[model samples]
Target: MYHAIAQDIIKSIMADEYTTKLPTEKVLMQRFDASRNTIRKAIDVVFRHGLLRRVQGSGNFIIKQPANSGTILNLSIGFDRAAMVEGGPLVSQVVTFDKVQADDRLAGQGNIAVGTELYRVIRLRYLKGTLYDLEESYFPRTVVPFLSTDSVQHSIFAFLREAYDIYGSTTENYVHQVRLNDERAALIGVPVGDKTMCLDAINYLANGDVFNFSQTFFVYPDLELYYHTENIDLQK
Candidate 1:
């Protein structure tokens, strides 16, 4: 029910129905015939999609949609989904896809037991024919056994959800501003020593097992991190 409400709200936003601020909670509850909790949940769904922002004393405000900017949706579903939300198709060029047994280093990084089999995948992500990001991911074969080249070209998450009914529940990301090496630089069409936003993430399944470990480099200049607010102090 909340998902349906969220879709309606998104549709309305796209149609310029709510351009500045959303209606009050009481007004929304009356309008949708939903409970306050459900309306709030729907608002959270829109917030995660980068469409709405909450002001403390003010009501929910609409965020101006960026012009051809690749948005990083806070949901952490997949890059393909994020691109789809921004009205563009995300293209992937698979660089490496192979099976390997996890060593001590890999196990520690992925929080999986040693000797577990994992598929190592490296891909260059493009938006509208321009290189946008690079991703190197490791997926446990126990969680994802048969990944095809077509899945690698498209979306791994979609393949998992459709094939195995597996979905991403959470992601723990470590953000860093790092300099690109010679090889990484050339792949993403950046100069060596160029600073890039890199995220190392451990993606988990609903059962709480680590499904994937990925390192992604954002080479795009207009990358936005909308999840983080301006006033909140990030802990060290």
Candidate 2:
């Protein structure tokens, strides 16, 4: 019932010219002929999905649709599963490809020794032609060999899975608020010191082998991040 009402509201918003502010609870109740509980549930659905944001003083306002950005992380599922779902135009451009000795941070994340050879792959991502994120990834040399510049033009995960049957089953992710420094800002085409969100992820294969360590910076002004999580019953 609430889902039906929510769909109708979404349809109405899409069909309208002006930005659609959600009506008051009373008005929505009247229109949908729903109880207060039903209307509230319907609103919660859209809010959780990033369609709406509520201001303390102002009523609920529609969050402008993300230009073409789609949620990139699904905590409850693997990356391969999520990629198969319908979504936006996701694209990647290789920025840097080189071999370097791992430092303390890189070694720690990859569970490798310091000074071990590591393949560094940097990429810029676009969503529907809009620059969305800048990512830097490090892989232990023992895991991937002869990684060429052209290999990063497509999905790294795809390449790894197809070539070596390697895929991440577990990931440790950390998110932090950061200010982009000059070099990073320039790479992402944003002004220096721009507010950004940084994500550091270390991914492990089913065998508990650390395969990839990555840091991604998202320029906040032009890009948005959406994260979703679901609790799964592990007892089964």
Candidate 3:
């Protein structure tokens, strides 16, 4: 129930329904028919996203508002190609991880032949437990045969090194807007018709072998993708 309330308030904030401080806890309790504990928990969830600041003597105040809380994604210079900065702590909630057969489209993405085996993983990324994106990855089983739930819970790159000595990889990134399905919409705190940023990436191994192909869906309103370009003359 608290989760529902939190999401409702978040939706309102996203819609620009409220810019000032939230109503009193008692008022919210009456509005939502929830207990004080539930209301506080809900507010805490919002607070974790840097949306609200709780004052000791007074009450919670807006901290980030809407425009400032969007996430930023980047390609780190030489390592950790998957790093992105969203609001709050970045977390991955594993949805499903299974060994599946790679079809034609999947093979093209992984640079492998059709019918090859691949591990398909779906995860919902959270910023301080608020839904950020829906990430789906296709990893060749031959390349990462030892992939496990524990390894995937955190950073897959780190786990690859610890288990298989696999290191850095070159990545190809593509960005576009995509409409989400109902399931994905619910996961990312948006409606079905709403469009979101989609990042399609393929990572290669040190020896130029294909490692992982991933797609991420981001829903936060304020987001920026950074790219460093050289040799282009601004004077031109």
Top lDDT: which candidate number? Answer: 1
Candidate 2 lDDT at 202 equals: 80
The C-alpha RMSD in Å for every predicted model, in order, reads 5.3, 11.5, 15.1
Note the Cα lDDT for every prediction shown.
0.76, 0.68, 0.71
Candidate 2 lDDT, 89-139, residue by residue in tens: 357788788889988877876677899888898888776676767889888
Worst 10 residues of 2 by lDDT: 76-85
Measured by TM-score, the strongest candidate is 1
lDDT of 2: 0.68
Backbone clashes in model 1, listed as residue pairs = none
Ranking by TM-score: 1, 3, 2
> Candidates 1 and 2: which is better by TM-score?
1
Stretches of candidate 1 exceeding 4 Å from the true structure: 1-87, 189-191, 228-236
TM for candidate 1 is 0.68
lDDT, candidate 1, 45-143, per-residue tens: 677656777998998998876556546434332322432335346788899989999999889888899999999999998777777789889999888
Q: What's the lDDT for residue 196 in model 1? A: 87
